[model samples]
Target: MRTNLDFSPLFRSSIGFDRMLNALEAASRAETIDTWPPYDIAKTGENDYRIVMAVAGLSQDELAITQEQNMLIVAGQKANSDDVEYLHRGIAGRSFQRRFELADHVKVVGAGLVNGLLTIDLKREIPEEMKPRQIEIRTGQGMPKAETKQIEAKKQAA
Candidate 1:
């Protein structure tokens, strides 16, 4: 498929974070990768996500999980059986690799193998200082210095 991307005006517009833009571009070009080894991405909470990939017949020793830059790669290599002759090999246990893009401030909590399913947990954390704070617009200069000073003194005393 041959197609043209028109971005003549994008260069003139204000672009932020070239890495983020590059990630978006890469995501656009990347398909679902593959449907095999089906997986599920579920939202556990408001800021938490869990990825469950059905990698049956794969042991924890045969699989590895690691994060590189902003990408998380889950790969596995099944120890090939040299002596076994299969009359009917239905399950193709060769090897597979899966990649996922981790958003900003997102960190992988941990991963575990449960019933042949690899469950990876990720969470986004926003620090109290980084969280949005509402500023109260004082109509006058501000609260009485005496009261503010008293409050500060009380906090220090505590």
Candidate 2:
């Protein structure tokens, strides 16, 4: 059973969050969820993350990884071979594409395939201007006083 959620109430009061809300709605309304070629996402460090996907039988040349803005795309296409005949086929060798939404400032650092597992590393690098900084507050004793000026009325002419 699938349940649909209404995000209208949240949209009415929130601003500049339309993309997040739309993503939620789209995820909930998806007719079929892909579960093949299982994957896992882990937070290895404070600003570092890793995604490990089980892409058994796929070679480095057969897989592709791309990063566009705040999105990560991974796709795999296996070359077809008809010379060998199999009595029973259990392993999945079909082409698949998976997309992941990344947060602001997050970027893909590196990727490697080992023992049929593809590991992707990511890091969030905040710009110096956007990072939080401590501001020092001055005491009253060291503050500079404002310069004051006095105005006098002109003498009346005789």
Q: Pick the candidate with the highest lDDT.
A: 2
Best by TM-score: 2
What's the TM-score of each model vs. the native? Answer: 0.78, 0.86
lDDT of 2 by residue, 19-124 (tens): 8998899888889889988999999999999999999999999999999998899999999998989999998999999999898899999999999999999999
> Over all chains combined, what TM-score does candidate 1 have?
0.78
- Output the lDDT of residue 88, model 2: 93
Candidate 2: which stretches are off by over 4 Å?
Answer: 144-158
The CA root-mean-square deviation of candidate 1, after full C-alpha superposition on the true structure, stands at 10.0
Candidate 2, 16: how far from true, in Å?
Answer: 2.3
RMSD of each: 10.0, 3.9
lDDT of each: 0.84, 0.96
* Pairs clashing within candidate 2: none
